[model samples]
Target: MGSSSRRNTMSDVTIIGLGPMGSTLARTLLKNGTNVTVWNRTREKAEQLIREGAEFNPEAAAAVSASPIVIVCVANYEASHNILGSHEVAKNLEGRLVVELSTGTPQDARNSETRVREQGADYLDGAILATPAQIGMPDTPIFLSGSEAAFRRSEPVLKILAGNLIYMGEAVGAASAWDLATLATTFGAMFGFFHGSRILESEGYRVDSFGSMMADISPVLGQMIKYEGEIIQTGAYENPQSSVKTCRGTADLWLKQALEAGINNEFPTFAMGLFNKAKAAGYENEELAAVMKVLR
Candidate 1:
């Protein structure tokens, strides 16, 4: 049988929110032939999904009891806790699996797991790494952690929403940790890209062309990062292909160009501060990865 047919034979799901992400999730599951029960604080938000074959449950507690698997996607842990942490909802959670797709810190995941387990339900923390528009695509990723048994129970239904299901072992906090760490790296590069765009604009270059160039060279950039990561992993900061001093010089050049072009220098200034700390600590001759030591 196809996955959709198998899902029909499997357990139903309860979706406990109706925001963009939650609505997309419910729609995906409904498209896959799974019986979906939906509830949101704002009941009107569930209207479209209900018209699309989702059964609407007005009360949060009743929604939790409507399915064997409950997926909670809310703004944050605080909102999720307010919805599911109540005695009425907590009591209905027994013998069911609660899959939390809300964004939160590691501590929040830990606390949510504890609360769910206290109510005799299995809990799995998850982080969806794609936007609402990406849901149900074969390449869409969802990171999950906590309660291997719970994961096994919910895997089929979860796969309807995302194809790439990355189980991060039994640590309830791993999903959130991985998500936040990846976001940090992504945003750090994005800020630098923004600064680069400003530089190109000052030089009268097309920003779209610069973006396309960056996309083309991304593999090369990835390789460079991999090399530095290995060096950092082994603490082999000497015999550098690129030294801290060399990078510092680049930052200095950026600052100089920013001054001449009369543009914002925040990116270069921030970079220079870190390089100066490494230089002051006598890592000037070491590999660029040695800056991690300064960070540590």
Candidate 2:
């Protein structure tokens, strides 16, 4: 095998794509004293990093061949495939590790893992839960999944790019699945907040005060998350105390007001649907946790 031209060193890393996130990763690696080689479809995008002591490669295959750990942060799975799927590049990737930080579905991540494994390379699917600015910070959360060996081998490099690095087991698809689900939930809540704030603004209510109230009440969502597990596991919605019917009625009234205030009720409407379904399922006297039945 002619000694497999790719070099493996604790300080060697290569990054494909030079978008904000990709560029940030490159800079972080470089700042941490890692030798970084970067490539982008548009060559000029790598200019900034070049000035930061990063080696710029004009060819994608050469970039992949430059290091043991190759990180890709492209636009999508297809773009990721385009760079790593080439015959020459794939052959050169043998015994190397590919860490994909691209935004994609679980299926996409799994499929990429399969392809990379076929090339005798290691694959790790990663999801960055923070923005570009958060890269290299201590609190940036990066979810990783794939082979345990691959994850452990690349931990040092990955840590340079994230504040908090989490391993989500060995299934490459797990990270992507969890990432997408979390993204949907976060955006849903933000959209609901925006709708409420706009309605209050229209009625001459101070948006700042509403924002403060939301900040204070946001902890309740965390409580709901903690209680959700108990509700699901025991199938017990006994709010011991509170009645589901009362909660349902209150939610319905809230939804109606949302609609009447010229605010979009889609968010609250969706919640109401679940609440109503649970109530109809003979859980009216149960606690609000009974709504899990509808959610399930």
Clashing pairs in 1: none
Ten-residue segment with the worst summed lDDT in candidate 1? Answer: 1-10
Q: 66-152 in candidate 2: lDDT tens per residue?
A: 888999999999999998998878888898999999999999999999999999999999999999888898989999999999999
TM-score of 2: 0.88
Candidates in order, TM-scores: namely 0.94, 0.88
Candidate lDDT values, in order: 0.92, 0.84
Q: How many pairs of residues in model 1 come into backbone collision? A: 0
Candidate 1 displacement at residue 50 in angstroms: 0.9
